[model samples]
Target: MSNIRGFRIQHDSLTEKQRIFIDDFSKRYTEKTKKSKNYISSNRYHLCDWMNSLGFKLSLKEMLYPIISHSSEGAYFTDIDGNRYIDIAMGYGVCFHGHKPKFVYDAIKERLERGFELGPQTVESGEAAYLIHHLTGVDRVTFCGTGSEAVMFALRIARGFTRKKKIVIFANSFHGTFDGVLGKMAEDITIPVSPGTTEGMVEDLVVLEYGSDAALDYIRKNADGLAAVMAEPVQTRNPSLRPVEFLKEIRKLADEKGFLLIFDETVTGFRVHYGGIQKLFDIKADIVIYGKALGGGMPIAAVCGRDDVMKIVDGGYYSFGDETYPDPYVIFFAGTYYKHPLSIVATLASLKEIKRNGNHLQEYTNNLTSILVEKLNNLFKQKSVPIVVHSFSSFFRFITVDPYPFVSDPIELEILFLLMILKGVYTWERRICYLSTQHTIQDVEDIVKIVDESIDEMRSGGFSFTF
Candidate 1:
């Protein structure tokens, strides 16, 4: 095991006790869910077999077969084999109003009657943009197909407006899979986390320790060369780690030094509150990126910011003999389906619903999350397990008890995921779970009960970890 600044990189193979427990649990699960196993084996053969044939090992499949989903409604989904599971993952925080929500569906159905895809512009698109501007208080809004594209555009706008070459990002903060921002930094300062990063990519990135005084010092020193400081207020993978003070400080520095502060609220947008983390914290950002829940499960995302910074995408009419020609240096941002009718209608409907009932939904989910964390911690204490549950708003995760470390071990987290699935609860491998408006108080209680039972079973199987 190599401990890198409190992060344990465990390379040792699974212990004998762990192997025995896993084998026993697998056998029991297979016997109990025979139909599901058969369906998965017959239909989902390509995920593992095909990948292995291509010389790529699929580790997640080795642990558990993919649960072939048949249908989803509210906060639950049913597998093809007639098994139902409570969906706490919620499409990785996309289904805020839950699956097949009536408001979103009705809006989409209406648009479907008119048309699914039109030209580059639509009345609904303008309405959606106006709603986003109204809700976020941003002066302008631009649409894209996905969250990754939105982040990419936001970065381009930042660099274009500030005329700076470098961007500062915090360690463990996930903006997107974009090549420019995917680099990770090690604590040693010598080792690079993104050696495969394309040439010229490393030179433009500055990785800082999340919420450290040293990071603040670095920002103060290099703010002139930085185009923006991009971050997620609450990291999706590690929900326990929130740097509130650091964010406030970043805003102050951005204001003082004339650099942009960008908040990637892709996961925390409407789910945290009606506005976002900005509204929750009462701290504004120069640029904001929103996705996931904005489209109510449709493939849509938006980049909103001050008017001066957002005008980089404006291409004035030149071919039509307008007086103002388009600026050659302006950043180009467009897509074939930039604002599809379905996405726009869904977004508008989602916003209307949220505006009407956002407070009640936020309160319900927040209260449920609080109750869940308390109950899970109590269970962990009772079982003498070195695990803890932490939550921020509707997002929660299970972390090891060692001054707040994310569960980084694949095998350990996979085992827990399988156990939860066996007990009719689903979550991501990061041990992160989400709550939706579709979930009731009874549903929260059931989730807690299942988690408690799963931990007790693990204890009986001799599953223990030392911090």
Candidate 2:
């Protein structure tokens, strides 16, 4: 079993007990999700479940189709099979307030009843902008449709404001599906991460080791042509990594090098704290992009930054009384659905709720998640499981330990996710999970028990985990 390397489903490695478990599990899961499986298979041409595009294997055939959600409320969502699962996925961090939050839903419904009024500015846009500025301490705020759009516009604004072509991005940080931010480390050079993206698309991108002294030195040496340094304050892939000192040093360099420091806080913004990582780490960035929880599950995004930097969007803000015309170098920035009334209304409701509760809401949720993570980790340790739980605020992930001899194949870890689903805990593809404001102490206890039982079942099947 230790010789296995990748995600191959080696039938020979499975013991008799494991095979029995797999057969039963597959049959039950298939029967439960038969409708979803058939629907997805029939719509294969048009509907692409890209998240589970890891290829078809016998081991994963029954578990491939995502549980079709029939209804959701609070910390639980019901699948089409009428099964309710504790929703730790939490809409991929968009449901900090939980599924179907009343405040946001009411706001959207009210706005819908009144009017959409798409073209002209909505009544809620200013309030949303004001709330964001107040919450994040940014001098200006701009609206966008999604995280990717906000990221692309933020990069353009950085470049336009700084008049520099190159941007510094860190390794192991995801900035969205934007083509410009899709560069990966290739030996000593940075290259496009996807096939369609050419070398020219990533030429201006400088990818460096995240939280390393070498990366800081590189930035210092090449600061002349650098417009911005972008990063996810706490990487989602590894939330335990809190590079506080490293980020502070980067902030210093941004000050000295005349480059804008951009924080891609799409996931971390409101989830980590009311002010995001900037408040958590006490390091300010020139620009910050916010999304996910900003609109309370509504599709909305925002770019907030210093006034001088953001003024380029509207040509430096000239008033009628002031003799000055719109004089600053203007950059093209517009979207047909930039501030859709529903999105803006939802955002307003979310921001207002955050304002009313302040950091207490975040503190309670973070503390709750911390306790849950500790309970899970202690259970893992007591059982000699080769996995560690780490979290940044309410978001947490199960990280496998390195150099463990017992865990032969990655499929063993994959099975853990399936077990989680079967045991009534909805998790993500990468094992990342979130604790929403709606999650209770009882929910945490229930999750811990589920995990303990799941691990015990897997252990009985000779699925190895080294001490």
The estimated TM-scores of all candidates read 0.88, 0.94
Q: Kindly list the per-residue Cα lDDT of model 1 for residues 324-420, writing each as its tens digit.
A: 6766668977688888888889998988888888577777888888887887888778766667777899888776755324444434445666788
lDDT of 2 by residue, 257-322 (tens): 899999999999888899999888898899999999999999999999998898899866677876
| Best candidate (score: TM-score) | 2
Instruction: Give the runs in model 2 whose Cα sits over 4 Å from its true position.
Output: 1-17, 52-58, 403-409
Candidate 2 C-alpha error for residue 15, in Å = 4.1
Model 1 has an lDDT value of 0.78
